[model samples]
Target: MSRRTLLQNAAIAGAAAVPVLLAGARSAGAKMSQTAVAYQGSPKGSSKCSNCKLFEPPSSCKSVAGDISPNGWCKIWVKA
Candidate 1:
């Protein structure tokens, strides 16, 4: 193949790989340790995991490691 054709094909392949790479990166997002985010088992006033945007329902947190409580509080909590 001509040098220009090879370069063009490489560019297209790179572009096609971008979405797959991004998807993997997104799916492998890292979560913070409970201690790192000052996680607590109870609410802080009215703020709690259930009301936080990062809450994953039942007993999980999108940004916190291990089992979480709906009534739990953390420094990273954001109003849902």
Candidate 2:
């Protein structure tokens, strides 16, 4: 697998380019900002995230399991 794909499937979430939260920074029930990222874009005719060059198909992510959300976006979102 390519490096990009490897990064996406990593068991270490922070190593996946996601920023790690400070340990003990939040108390119970504290609402943290939901950091949303925007897609830069991809080659025309692209249809799904699994098909993206950066996506690690057939694997689960730290946030979601069963299947990776092709529409999923994050601060690490990069153009294909």
Residue 18 error, candidate 2, Å: 11
Per-residue lDDT tens digits of candidate 2, residues 1-80? Answer: 99988877775666644343422333233323324323323323444455445456554333322344665444443355
Instruction: Give the root-mean-square deviation of each candidate in angstroms.
Output: 8.9, 13.9
Task: Find the candidate with the highest lDDT and give its number.
Answer: 1
lDDT of each: 0.88, 0.43
For candidate 1, write residues 1-80 as lDDT tens digits. Answer: 89999999999999999767645754789676899789999999999999999899899987788999999999888999
Error of 1 at 12 (Å): 41
Count residue pairs with overlapping backbones in model 2.
0
Residue 17 CA error for candidate 2 (Å)? 14
TM-score of 1: 0.65
How good is model 2 by TM-score? Answer: 0.25
